[model samples]
Target: MHCSTPKTSASLDPALLRANFPIFGNHPDLIYFDNASTSQKPFVVLDEVCRYHTEQCANAGRAAYSWSTQLDRAIEDTRARVAKFIGANAEDLAFTSGATESLNMVALAWGLLNLQDGDEIMLCQRDHKSAVLPWYNLKDILATQGKTIHIKTFAIHEVGDYDLKSIKDQVSPRTRLLAMTHIHHVFGLDMEVAEIREIVGDRVLISLDASQSVGHIKVDVAALNVDFLSFSGHKMFATTGTGGLWVNPRVKDSLRPMKLGGKSEATPEAGGLNLKHKNTAELLEAGTQNIAGILSLGKAVDLIDSIGLDAIESHVSDLTVYLYGKLLNLPGIIFAPGMGICRCEAGFGIMSFRFEQISNLDLSFVLDEENIFVRSGDHCTYARDTSEEYIRVSMHLYNTKDEIDQLIAVLEGVVG
Candidate 1:
């Protein structure tokens, strides 16, 4: 592997990690390249989920009973665990349905609370619909208050390079928030948000969707200096509908809750109104908690930590380089780092492309017939449509060189 980093991190054995996932045992020949959608959970995370339902099943933070106490403790501990995992305080994180819900909460709560007339939010075409939709859906609501939200995009060349000038030009003093993704869903474009932060200064609140890169890489919320960030637990090997949002400590008071009910992650008073609502995670998460999923998500973080982030990053980066090298030589493969429009090498979770001879769906079918799985089409960038439909081959810690080789063999005959 001619990667910029080391070829492999032998400290964490990829084969051993692969064995921990049950799907490999069930289908030995299966090559799961759609990890960006949802990752295959390790037995550790599954066991934690089952254990929660079997042993300590109870509603959290409601009753003084032992079961409720146990469940509540588990939920809070997991919250702290997830918080530390992302380099933030426990209070900064809030459990939600997923990144989508988390982002929506920010848009509906923070945007509604702070935005005024002539304020704007910046986004880009590369953003997944979930990233854009949350803010995009707010135009009408703001209009009622005589507010007009001017949405803008960061100018990106077809080659996927950032136009720094456009970033400086677009982010005016009236910009309220800059909403974008840490990694583009379609083609694995890992954006350097630190630079974007520098350009925007403190003019706008930076809300990042780190759904694609959080568990796979080392993401320090403090270091990124973002006001708000959201990520998916399912994509990080946790349960579906399990994720959290990180709200900057300073902004928690300004950001309101999207879902509210009679649940005591807080204390109630004799007046039937809140005596005190702590500005921690409790402020954002309301209603009955997903204790089982939250516990399992904690276990998922444990599984990733066991391998070590540096090792995991090294392994995937190497495999991506290897896959790029093999696939680039093939004719008609477009938009991968070394092929088509993008000239840089593929370095993250996905390698997306459109083939010349075969449609993406047809290619997906052929791979499916071979027991090789992949994802095709626009991949939920619903607003951003190009002339070509792209297929994404996303990788995880469990993926190996052998599986990549098998994929190359399948594509060689079809495209040649």
Candidate 2:
């Protein structure tokens, strides 16, 4: 679904927003166009993380000390904050290192438990390795488990568009799960999760890898109707080594927890080895936890909300559209025809293209020499049909028109 809210008289002041990030100050000439990889943290997030480690450091949820108790509430409150940010229930959300573990958690916990002989799982060619390998691991285990499982990869249009009718054809009585990314990292294809959900219905479970979609766009879990979703914090202006997994409550009891040890949320006996895990996310979390990183993640939710998601989406889209217009006149630049210009909805602030005169790596190297950063190569999309390495220019709220102009100027010189 698209977010097309009416623009207020006072639009986002990107310069003021850019000033909030410390990295820009540290390197005066740095043009960070690699947000799809990881976002630079705002001072608010950095301060929150710093405060957690220096002033209130403690292991949460286990100790009787006052610090631990307070930290426990703080951690849980962060969970509530993220849930509210995504329009999800706090009880349905759980903490993980990042989306990778989140995807793996669902694959091992749910897929391994539920999938058996005659059951089929569908994945797309563009899915990240994190999303693909977990299912592949499950496929490998099937032989030892004495089960027959079928895995299928459906085709997308050459322009990175999903064919819902083609997808419907792939589903059958044996089809159990449809695991794909809500926004593709390479092509920036925003799969119609709502429409895909309608296609699957109650017959096939939907697992969405929303690592690219979450912070870039406004995503309501209720609207998407996904059984499981995985997204990272570093991609969202939060600290790295922190992210989340959201499980639909309808199947919470069905998916077992992957990591388990020590005390839990509701277990009464102290130091009990084998204890009952509460139905909530406490069953999923273990060990000392990334207290600092999680707190920063909570702050990121607040930061994004304060800016307003609609404004962020609108601003990023405008920048992408403007960049596409400038690049179209340049020589030998190639992506899906009309992709960045016409299908701005499909490409969420990311433009992946190739320059015929220069190799993708050389193009990236030249951009880096100018202090303009972008990711190049396959972007972890090994399953895709495209053979040539590509240049990926990803934008964010802090990206100014001047930066895009600089990028276009450099590109023109290279092509000319």
Model 1, 160-194: lDDT tens digits are 54566787888888897988778766656667788
Highest-lDDT candidate:
2
| RMSD over all Cα atoms, model 2 | 2.8
Q: Which portions of model 1 miss their true places by more than 4 Å?
A: 1-11, 264-275, 336-346, 382-388
Spell out the clash pairs found in candidate 2: none
Q: Per-residue alpha-carbon lDDT of model 2 for 284-366, expressed as tens digits? A: 88777888999899999999999988788778777777777888888887874225533553247878888778888898999
TM-score per prediction, in order, is: 0.93, 0.94
| Residue clash pairs of candidate 1 | none
Residue 323 accuracy (lDDT) in model 1: 81
Where is model 2 poorest over a 10-residue stretch in terms of lDDT? 1-10
